[model samples]
Target: MITIPREIKEFIELQGIFAVGTTGVNNIPNISPRIFFRVDENVIYWLDFFKHKSYKNIQANPWVTISVFNKDDLKGFQFRGIVNFITDEPTKLEIKESIIKKTLEKNSSEKIKKLSEKIEVQVIRFEPKVCYSLNPDEFSDMCIGSDVDSTQLFQK
Candidate 1:
Protein backbone atom coordinates (compact mmCIF):
# COMPACT_ATOMS: atom_id res chain seq x y z
CA MET A 1 0.00 0.00 0.00
CA ILE A 2 1.03 3.63 -0.61
CA THR A 3 0.67 6.49 1.81
CA ILE A 4 0.42 10.23 1.21
CA PRO A 5 1.35 12.57 4.02
CA ARG A 6 0.80 16.32 4.42
CA GLU A 7 4.51 16.98 3.95
CA ILE A 8 4.45 15.28 0.57
CA LYS A 9 1.39 17.26 -0.58
CA GLU A 10 2.95 20.55 0.46
CA PHE A 11 6.23 19.69 -1.24
CA ILE A 12 4.57 18.78 -4.55
CA GLU A 13 2.54 21.97 -4.71
CA LEU A 14 5.51 24.19 -3.96
CA GLN A 15 7.81 22.77 -6.61
CA GLY A 16 8.05 24.36 -10.08
CA ILE A 17 9.12 21.33 -12.11
CA PHE A 18 8.22 17.65 -11.98
CA ALA A 19 9.25 14.60 -13.99
CA VAL A 20 6.64 12.39 -15.64
CA GLY A 21 7.43 8.82 -16.75
CA THR A 22 5.56 6.68 -19.23
CA THR A 23 6.00 3.29 -20.85
CA GLY A 24 5.48 2.24 -24.43
CA VAL A 25 3.57 -0.82 -25.68
CA ASN A 26 6.75 -2.84 -25.71
CA ASN A 27 7.51 -1.82 -22.13
CA ILE A 28 10.18 0.70 -23.02
CA PRO A 29 10.10 3.75 -20.71
CA ASN A 30 10.33 7.50 -21.26
CA ILE A 31 10.52 10.42 -18.88
CA SER A 32 10.02 14.14 -19.37
CA PRO A 33 10.09 17.31 -17.29
CA ARG A 34 6.77 19.06 -16.82
CA ILE A 35 5.38 22.16 -15.15
CA PHE A 36 2.28 21.06 -13.27
CA PHE A 37 -0.34 21.94 -10.69
CA ARG A 38 -2.14 19.90 -8.08
CA VAL A 39 -5.87 19.88 -8.77
CA ASP A 40 -6.68 17.93 -5.63
CA GLU A 41 -5.17 15.49 -3.15
CA ASN A 42 -4.78 12.78 -5.78
CA VAL A 43 -4.83 14.68 -9.05
CA ILE A 44 -2.10 16.64 -10.88
CA TYR A 45 -2.54 18.63 -14.09
CA TRP A 46 -0.11 19.69 -16.83
CA LEU A 47 -0.29 20.98 -20.39
CA ASP A 48 1.09 19.20 -23.43
CA PHE A 49 0.69 19.84 -27.11
CA PHE A 50 -0.17 17.07 -29.56
CA LYS A 51 3.54 16.99 -30.28
CA HIS A 52 6.11 15.27 -28.06
CA LYS A 53 6.90 11.61 -27.45
CA SER A 54 5.48 11.80 -23.91
CA TYR A 55 2.03 12.66 -25.21
CA LYS A 56 2.19 9.85 -27.74
CA ASN A 57 3.25 7.37 -25.09
CA ILE A 58 0.40 8.44 -22.78
CA GLN A 59 -2.11 8.09 -25.57
CA ALA A 60 -0.86 4.57 -26.08
CA ASN A 61 -0.62 3.84 -22.39
CA PRO A 62 -2.24 5.86 -19.60
CA TRP A 63 -0.08 4.46 -16.82
CA VAL A 64 2.46 7.03 -15.57
CA THR A 65 4.45 8.26 -12.59
CA ILE A 66 5.28 11.83 -11.56
CA SER A 67 8.02 12.93 -9.21
CA VAL A 68 8.71 16.33 -7.63
CA PHE A 69 11.03 17.68 -4.97
CA ASN A 70 12.19 20.72 -3.06
CA LYS A 71 15.68 21.65 -4.24
CA ASP A 72 16.80 23.04 -0.88
CA ASP A 73 15.62 20.13 1.28
CA LEU A 74 15.90 17.31 -1.27
CA LYS A 75 12.62 15.98 0.13
CA GLY A 76 10.02 14.99 -2.42
CA PHE A 77 7.13 12.75 -3.50
CA GLN A 78 6.87 10.10 -6.18
CA PHE A 79 3.37 9.81 -7.60
CA ARG A 80 2.04 6.84 -9.56
CA GLY A 81 -1.23 7.34 -11.35
CA ILE A 82 -3.48 6.98 -14.37
CA VAL A 83 -3.24 9.65 -17.08
CA ASN A 84 -6.24 11.30 -18.72
CA PHE A 85 -6.08 13.73 -21.62
CA ILE A 86 -8.40 16.73 -21.44
CA THR A 87 -9.16 19.08 -24.32
CA ASP A 88 -12.49 20.70 -23.50
CA GLU A 89 -12.74 24.47 -23.97
CA PRO A 90 -13.45 25.36 -20.33
CA THR A 91 -10.58 23.20 -19.12
CA LYS A 92 -8.35 24.76 -21.76
CA LEU A 93 -9.24 28.25 -20.56
CA GLU A 94 -8.57 27.27 -16.97
CA ILE A 95 -5.19 25.88 -18.02
CA LYS A 96 -4.44 29.08 -19.94
CA GLU A 97 -5.15 31.19 -16.87
CA SER A 98 -2.98 28.93 -14.76
CA ILE A 99 -0.14 29.12 -17.25
CA ILE A 100 -0.44 32.89 -17.49
CA LYS A 101 -0.39 33.31 -13.74
CA LYS A 102 2.43 30.89 -13.16
CA THR A 103 4.63 31.88 -16.09
CA LEU A 104 4.00 35.59 -16.62
CA GLU A 105 5.15 36.48 -13.12
CA LYS A 106 8.75 36.03 -14.24
CA ASN A 107 8.59 36.08 -18.04
CA SER A 108 8.08 38.74 -20.71
CA SER A 109 5.00 38.80 -22.97
CA GLU A 110 6.97 37.73 -26.03
CA LYS A 111 8.39 34.72 -24.29
CA ILE A 112 4.99 33.77 -22.92
CA LYS A 113 3.37 33.96 -26.35
CA LYS A 114 6.10 31.89 -27.91
CA LEU A 115 5.64 29.20 -25.31
CA SER A 116 1.85 29.37 -25.55
CA GLU A 117 2.01 28.89 -29.30
CA LYS A 118 4.36 25.97 -29.02
CA ILE A 119 1.91 24.30 -26.66
CA GLU A 120 -1.72 23.66 -27.49
CA VAL A 121 -2.16 23.18 -23.74
CA GLN A 122 -3.79 19.78 -23.58
CA VAL A 123 -4.19 18.98 -19.89
CA ILE A 124 -2.70 15.74 -18.60
CA ARG A 125 -4.45 14.74 -15.39
CA PHE A 126 -2.81 12.28 -13.02
CA GLU A 127 -4.90 10.48 -10.42
CA PRO A 128 -2.41 9.13 -7.94
CA LYS A 129 -2.73 5.53 -6.75
CA VAL A 130 0.54 5.38 -4.80
CA CYS A 131 2.97 7.82 -3.30
CA TYR A 132 6.40 7.64 -1.66
CA SER A 133 8.09 10.46 0.24
CA LEU A 134 11.73 10.83 1.24
CA ASN A 135 13.11 12.59 4.31
CA PRO A 136 16.84 11.94 4.19
CA ASP A 137 17.72 12.67 7.82
CA GLU A 138 15.06 11.13 10.04
CA PHE A 139 14.22 8.23 7.72
CA SER A 140 17.70 7.27 6.63
CA ASP A 141 17.55 4.03 8.62
CA MET A 142 14.20 3.08 7.07
CA CYS A 143 15.60 3.24 3.56
CA ILE A 144 16.39 -0.46 3.40
CA GLY A 145 13.25 -1.77 5.10
CA SER A 146 11.75 -4.92 3.63
CA ASP A 147 8.40 -3.26 2.87
CA VAL A 148 9.85 -0.28 1.05
CA ASP A 149 11.48 -0.56 -2.34
CA SER A 150 12.88 2.75 -3.54
CA THR A 151 13.69 1.47 -7.00
CA GLN A 152 10.17 0.16 -7.58
CA LEU A 153 8.68 3.37 -6.22
CA PHE A 154 10.13 5.44 -9.05
CA GLN A 155 9.77 2.84 -11.78
CA LYS A 156 7.03 2.99 -14.40
Candidate 2:
Protein backbone atom coordinates (compact mmCIF):
# COMPACT_ATOMS: atom_id res chain seq x y z
CA MET A 1 0.00 0.00 0.00
CA ILE A 2 1.16 3.53 -0.82
CA THR A 3 0.06 6.93 0.41
CA ILE A 4 -0.92 9.71 -1.98
CA PRO A 5 0.60 13.11 -1.28
CA ARG A 6 -1.50 16.07 -0.14
CA GLU A 7 -0.30 18.25 -3.01
CA ILE A 8 -1.49 15.69 -5.53
CA LYS A 9 -4.82 15.36 -3.76
CA GLU A 10 -5.38 19.09 -3.93
CA PHE A 11 -4.63 19.09 -7.62
CA ILE A 12 -7.12 16.28 -8.21
CA GLU A 13 -9.86 18.07 -6.33
CA LEU A 14 -9.72 21.06 -8.62
CA GLN A 15 -10.16 19.00 -11.78
CA GLY A 16 -13.38 17.51 -13.11
CA ILE A 17 -11.99 15.11 -15.69
CA PHE A 18 -9.34 12.44 -15.23
CA ALA A 19 -8.01 9.83 -17.62
CA VAL A 20 -7.78 6.20 -16.60
CA GLY A 21 -5.51 3.77 -18.44
CA THR A 22 -6.15 0.04 -18.67
CA THR A 23 -4.60 -2.82 -20.61
CA GLY A 24 -6.51 -4.77 -23.24
CA VAL A 25 -5.63 -7.62 -25.58
CA ASN A 26 -1.97 -8.04 -26.57
CA ASN A 27 -1.12 -5.65 -23.75
CA ILE A 28 -2.56 -2.71 -25.63
CA PRO A 29 -3.45 0.10 -23.28
CA ASN A 30 -6.81 1.88 -23.37
CA ILE A 31 -7.31 5.30 -21.85
CA SER A 32 -10.70 6.77 -20.99
CA PRO A 33 -11.93 10.02 -19.50
CA ARG A 34 -13.67 9.77 -16.14
CA ILE A 35 -15.96 12.56 -15.02
CA PHE A 36 -17.13 11.54 -11.57
CA PHE A 37 -14.51 10.79 -8.94
CA ARG A 38 -13.52 11.80 -5.44
CA VAL A 39 -10.25 11.18 -3.63
CA ASP A 40 -10.26 10.19 0.02
CA GLU A 41 -6.86 10.05 1.66
CA ASN A 42 -4.82 7.51 -0.33
CA VAL A 43 -7.91 5.93 -1.83
CA ILE A 44 -9.76 7.21 -4.91
CA TYR A 45 -13.29 6.32 -5.82
CA TRP A 46 -15.27 7.06 -8.98
CA LEU A 47 -18.64 6.34 -10.47
CA ASP A 48 -18.29 3.95 -13.38
CA PHE A 49 -21.02 5.15 -15.72
CA PHE A 50 -22.24 2.85 -18.49
CA LYS A 51 -19.77 0.05 -17.71
CA HIS A 52 -17.97 0.54 -21.05
CA LYS A 53 -14.81 -0.86 -22.60
CA SER A 54 -12.59 0.31 -19.76
CA TYR A 55 -14.78 -1.51 -17.28
CA LYS A 56 -14.46 -4.71 -19.28
CA ASN A 57 -10.71 -4.26 -19.48
CA ILE A 58 -10.48 -3.86 -15.72
CA GLN A 59 -12.31 -7.11 -15.31
CA ALA A 60 -9.63 -8.81 -17.39
CA ASN A 61 -6.69 -7.00 -15.74
CA PRO A 62 -6.63 -5.45 -12.31
CA TRP A 63 -3.66 -3.15 -12.85
CA VAL A 64 -4.57 0.37 -13.90
CA THR A 65 -3.25 3.92 -14.00
CA ILE A 66 -4.90 7.34 -13.72
CA SER A 67 -3.63 10.58 -15.27
CA VAL A 68 -4.99 13.88 -13.98
CA PHE A 69 -3.69 17.22 -15.27
CA ASN A 70 -4.86 20.66 -14.35
CA LYS A 71 -6.57 22.02 -17.43
CA ASP A 72 -5.09 25.44 -16.82
CA ASP A 73 -1.37 24.54 -16.83
CA LEU A 74 -1.36 20.87 -17.88
CA LYS A 75 0.63 20.09 -14.74
CA GLY A 76 -0.67 17.02 -12.94
CA PHE A 77 -0.02 13.66 -11.32
CA GLN A 78 -0.26 10.07 -12.50
CA PHE A 79 -1.63 7.45 -10.09
CA ARG A 80 -0.98 3.77 -10.69
CA GLY A 81 -2.71 0.98 -8.83
CA ILE A 82 -5.30 -1.76 -8.75
CA VAL A 83 -9.05 -1.20 -8.50
CA ASN A 84 -11.92 -2.78 -6.59
CA PHE A 85 -15.52 -2.29 -7.64
CA ILE A 86 -18.29 -1.51 -5.17
CA THR A 87 -21.85 -2.36 -6.12
CA ASP A 88 -23.40 -2.15 -2.70
CA GLU A 89 -26.35 -0.05 -1.64
CA PRO A 90 -24.16 2.42 0.20
CA THR A 91 -22.23 3.18 -2.95
CA LYS A 92 -25.47 3.57 -4.87
CA LEU A 93 -26.82 5.94 -2.25
CA GLU A 94 -23.66 8.00 -2.43
CA ILE A 95 -23.90 8.18 -6.19
CA LYS A 96 -27.50 9.29 -5.94
CA GLU A 97 -26.58 12.01 -3.52
CA SER A 98 -23.81 13.20 -5.77
CA ILE A 99 -26.12 13.27 -8.74
CA ILE A 100 -28.77 15.19 -6.83
CA LYS A 101 -26.21 17.69 -5.63
CA LYS A 102 -24.90 18.26 -9.11
CA THR A 103 -28.37 18.62 -10.46
CA LEU A 104 -29.21 21.23 -7.88
CA GLU A 105 -26.02 23.10 -8.59
CA LYS A 106 -26.64 23.12 -12.31
CA ASN A 107 -30.39 23.79 -11.87
CA SER A 108 -31.25 21.19 -14.45
CA SER A 109 -34.71 19.74 -15.08
CA GLU A 110 -36.21 17.92 -12.10
CA LYS A 111 -37.42 15.07 -14.27
CA ILE A 112 -33.98 14.58 -15.74
CA LYS A 113 -32.44 14.74 -12.30
CA LYS A 114 -34.81 12.12 -11.03
CA LEU A 115 -33.94 9.81 -13.91
CA SER A 116 -30.22 10.39 -13.44
CA GLU A 117 -30.42 9.50 -9.77
CA LYS A 118 -32.03 6.23 -10.65
CA ILE A 119 -29.40 5.16 -13.13
CA GLU A 120 -27.19 2.33 -11.88
CA VAL A 121 -23.60 3.39 -11.47
CA GLN A 122 -20.69 1.22 -10.43
CA VAL A 123 -18.40 2.61 -7.77
CA ILE A 124 -14.72 1.87 -8.31
CA ARG A 125 -12.29 2.01 -5.42
CA PHE A 126 -8.63 2.41 -6.32
CA GLU A 127 -5.70 1.66 -4.04
CA PRO A 128 -2.78 3.70 -5.27
CA LYS A 129 0.55 1.86 -5.48
CA VAL A 130 2.56 4.67 -7.10
CA CYS A 131 2.32 8.32 -8.01
CA TYR A 132 4.51 10.61 -10.12
CA SER A 133 4.38 14.36 -10.36
CA LEU A 134 4.39 15.51 -13.98
CA ASN A 135 5.75 18.62 -15.62
CA PRO A 136 7.25 19.63 -18.93
CA ASP A 137 10.59 20.67 -17.46
CA GLU A 138 11.43 17.67 -15.28
CA PHE A 139 8.65 15.39 -16.60
CA SER A 140 8.98 13.05 -13.58
CA ASP A 141 9.56 14.59 -10.19
CA MET A 142 8.43 13.88 -6.64
CA CYS A 143 7.68 10.19 -7.08
CA ILE A 144 6.00 8.07 -4.38
CA GLY A 145 5.96 4.36 -4.98
CA SER A 146 5.67 1.17 -2.88
CA ASP A 147 8.71 1.72 -0.64
CA VAL A 148 8.57 4.94 1.35
CA ASP A 149 12.09 6.41 1.24
CA SER A 150 13.77 9.71 1.81
CA THR A 151 13.49 10.60 -1.86
CA GLN A 152 10.12 8.95 -2.41
CA LEU A 153 7.13 8.04 -0.28
CA PHE A 154 6.57 4.35 -1.13
CA GLN A 155 7.69 1.59 -3.49
CA LYS A 156 5.87 -1.54 -4.68
Candidate 3:
Protein backbone atom coordinates (compact mmCIF):
# COMPACT_ATOMS: atom_id res chain seq x y z
CA MET A 1 0.00 0.00 0.00
CA ILE A 2 1.20 3.50 -0.74
CA THR A 3 0.61 6.57 1.37
CA ILE A 4 -0.64 9.85 -0.15
CA PRO A 5 1.46 12.90 0.55
CA ARG A 6 -0.21 16.18 1.45
CA GLU A 7 0.99 17.77 -1.77
CA ILE A 8 -0.58 14.99 -3.83
CA LYS A 9 -3.87 15.36 -2.01
CA GLU A 10 -3.83 19.09 -2.62
CA PHE A 11 -3.11 18.57 -6.30
CA ILE A 12 -6.07 16.29 -6.71
CA GLU A 13 -8.36 18.76 -5.02
CA LEU A 14 -7.30 21.49 -7.41
CA GLN A 15 -7.67 19.44 -10.56
CA GLY A 16 -11.01 19.44 -12.41
CA ILE A 17 -11.06 15.94 -13.86
CA PHE A 18 -9.89 12.48 -12.92
CA ALA A 19 -10.01 9.14 -14.72
CA VAL A 20 -12.07 6.51 -12.96
CA GLY A 21 -11.53 2.77 -13.54
CA THR A 22 -13.96 0.07 -12.55
CA THR A 23 -14.59 -3.62 -13.19
CA GLY A 24 -17.83 -5.47 -13.75
CA VAL A 25 -19.00 -8.72 -12.15
CA ASN A 26 -17.58 -10.65 -15.08
CA ASN A 27 -14.20 -8.97 -14.58
CA ILE A 28 -14.53 -6.66 -17.53
CA PRO A 29 -12.79 -3.38 -16.79
CA ASN A 30 -14.15 0.01 -17.72
CA ILE A 31 -12.62 3.47 -17.51
CA SER A 32 -14.17 6.89 -17.88
CA PRO A 33 -13.31 10.52 -17.25
CA ARG A 34 -15.04 12.21 -14.32
CA ILE A 35 -15.18 15.48 -12.41
CA PHE A 36 -14.30 14.91 -8.78
CA PHE A 37 -13.31 16.57 -5.53
CA ARG A 38 -11.89 15.56 -2.21
CA VAL A 39 -14.26 15.21 0.71
CA ASP A 40 -11.59 14.37 3.25
CA GLU A 41 -8.18 12.66 3.60
CA ASN A 42 -9.63 9.17 3.08
CA VAL A 43 -12.56 9.93 0.83
CA ILE A 44 -13.08 11.42 -2.63
CA TYR A 45 -16.42 12.29 -4.25
CA TRP A 46 -17.53 12.16 -7.88
CA LEU A 47 -20.70 13.35 -9.56
CA ASP A 48 -22.07 10.38 -11.49
CA PHE A 49 -24.85 10.42 -14.01
CA PHE A 50 -26.92 7.22 -14.21
CA LYS A 51 -26.33 7.03 -17.98
CA HIS A 52 -22.56 6.38 -17.91
CA LYS A 53 -20.78 3.04 -18.11
CA SER A 54 -18.96 3.90 -14.89
CA TYR A 55 -22.24 3.92 -12.98
CA LYS A 56 -23.18 0.51 -14.33
CA ASN A 57 -19.77 -0.91 -13.50
CA ILE A 58 -19.89 0.50 -9.99
CA GLN A 59 -23.26 -1.04 -9.39
CA ALA A 60 -21.86 -4.41 -10.39
CA ASN A 61 -18.61 -4.00 -8.49
CA PRO A 62 -17.79 -1.34 -5.97
CA TRP A 63 -14.01 -1.60 -6.17
CA VAL A 64 -12.38 1.08 -8.32
CA THR A 65 -9.20 2.99 -9.11
CA ILE A 66 -8.88 6.67 -9.96
CA SER A 67 -6.03 8.59 -11.59
CA VAL A 68 -5.55 12.35 -11.74
CA PHE A 69 -2.58 14.23 -13.16
CA ASN A 70 -1.22 17.55 -14.29
CA LYS A 71 -1.43 17.63 -18.09
CA ASP A 72 1.61 19.86 -18.49
CA ASP A 73 3.80 18.61 -15.64
CA LEU A 74 3.43 14.85 -16.27
CA LYS A 75 3.10 14.31 -12.55
CA GLY A 76 0.05 12.73 -10.95
CA PHE A 77 -1.36 10.30 -8.44
CA GLN A 78 -3.44 7.09 -8.50
CA PHE A 79 -5.97 5.99 -5.92
CA ARG A 80 -7.36 2.48 -5.45
CA GLY A 81 -10.32 1.88 -3.23
CA ILE A 82 -13.92 0.84 -2.64
CA VAL A 83 -16.80 2.97 -3.91
CA ASN A 84 -20.25 3.71 -2.51
CA PHE A 85 -23.17 5.34 -4.30
CA ILE A 86 -25.02 8.13 -2.49
CA THR A 87 -28.47 9.07 -3.79
CA ASP A 88 -30.05 10.91 -0.89
CA GLU A 89 -31.71 14.02 -2.31
CA PRO A 90 -30.81 16.28 0.59
CA THR A 91 -27.16 15.29 0.52
CA LYS A 92 -27.08 15.58 -3.26
CA LEU A 93 -28.64 19.02 -3.18
CA GLU A 94 -26.18 20.17 -0.55
CA ILE A 95 -23.20 18.98 -2.55
CA LYS A 96 -24.62 20.45 -5.73
CA GLU A 97 -25.09 23.80 -4.01
CA SER A 98 -21.56 23.78 -2.68
CA ILE A 99 -20.07 22.85 -6.04
CA ILE A 100 -22.10 25.51 -7.82
CA LYS A 101 -21.11 28.11 -5.28
CA LYS A 102 -17.45 27.33 -5.77
CA THR A 103 -17.31 26.68 -9.49
CA LEU A 104 -20.08 28.86 -10.90
CA GLU A 105 -20.20 31.81 -8.58
CA LYS A 106 -21.14 34.31 -11.28
CA ASN A 107 -23.88 32.24 -12.89
CA SER A 108 -27.54 33.05 -12.24
CA SER A 109 -30.00 30.56 -10.71
CA GLU A 110 -31.59 29.95 -14.11
CA LYS A 111 -28.25 28.99 -15.60
CA ILE A 112 -27.47 26.81 -12.60
CA LYS A 113 -30.87 25.17 -12.92
CA LYS A 114 -30.27 24.37 -16.57
CA LEU A 115 -26.86 22.95 -15.81
CA SER A 116 -28.19 20.85 -12.97
CA GLU A 117 -30.93 19.44 -15.14
CA LYS A 118 -28.47 17.83 -17.51
CA ILE A 119 -26.60 16.07 -14.71
CA GLU A 120 -28.16 13.03 -13.07
CA VAL A 121 -26.16 13.92 -9.97
CA GLN A 122 -25.21 10.81 -8.04
CA VAL A 123 -22.34 11.08 -5.60
CA ILE A 124 -19.73 8.35 -5.53
CA ARG A 125 -17.60 8.20 -2.43
CA PHE A 126 -14.30 6.39 -2.69
CA GLU A 127 -12.45 5.24 0.42
CA PRO A 128 -8.88 4.87 -0.71
CA LYS A 129 -6.67 2.02 0.45
CA VAL A 130 -3.62 2.74 -1.68
CA CYS A 131 -2.19 5.78 -3.41
CA TYR A 132 0.81 6.26 -5.67
CA SER A 133 2.52 9.40 -6.89
CA LEU A 134 4.49 9.65 -10.11
CA ASN A 135 7.17 12.31 -10.03
CA PRO A 136 9.85 12.48 -12.73
CA ASP A 137 12.18 14.68 -10.71
CA GLU A 138 12.48 12.01 -8.03
CA PHE A 139 14.04 9.65 -10.58
CA SER A 140 16.21 12.20 -12.33
CA ASP A 141 19.44 10.82 -10.88
CA MET A 142 18.64 7.30 -12.08
CA CYS A 143 17.60 8.56 -15.49
CA ILE A 144 20.85 10.46 -15.91
CA GLY A 145 22.97 7.52 -14.71
CA SER A 146 21.27 4.77 -16.72
CA ASP A 147 20.66 4.28 -20.44
CA VAL A 148 16.95 3.53 -19.95
CA ASP A 149 14.45 6.00 -21.39
CA SER A 150 13.28 8.39 -18.74
CA THR A 151 10.37 9.60 -20.83
CA GLN A 152 8.72 6.18 -20.57
CA LEU A 153 8.08 6.84 -16.90
CA PHE A 154 5.69 9.62 -17.74
CA GLN A 155 3.78 7.74 -20.44
CA LYS A 156 1.24 6.29 -18.08
lDDT tens digits, residues 4-63, model 1? 456565666567678889987777889888753444544667777546788888988897
Which window of ten consecutive residues has the lowest lDDT sum in model 2? 147-156
- What is the C-alpha lDDT profile of model 2 across 18-112, one tens digit per residue? 89999855578889886566777778877676677888888988778899987569687887788978767886678546644654465567665
| Clash pairs detected, candidate 2 | 145-154, 145-155, 146-154, 146-155, 146-156, 147-154, 147-155, 148-153, 148-154
Model 3 lDDT per residue over 1-156, tens place? 234556666787677678999988777888897653445555777666555677888889887888888978888777667898777888877776566555454445675446556656777778776555656556423321212243453244
Steric clash count of candidate 2: 9
TM, every model? 0.72, 0.76, 0.70
Ranked by TM-score, top first: 2, 1, 3
CA displacement after TM-score superposition, residue 53 of candidate 1 (Å) = 1.2
List the candidate numbers ranked by lDDT, top first: 2, 1, 3
Superior candidate under TM-score, 1 versus 3: 1
Q: Model 1: how far is 25 from its true place, Å?
A: 1.2
Off by over 4 Å in 1: 1-6, 36-38, 106-113, 137-156
For candidate 2, the TM-score is 0.76
- Residue pairs with clashing backbones, model 1: none
In candidate 1, position 75 carries an lDDT of 78
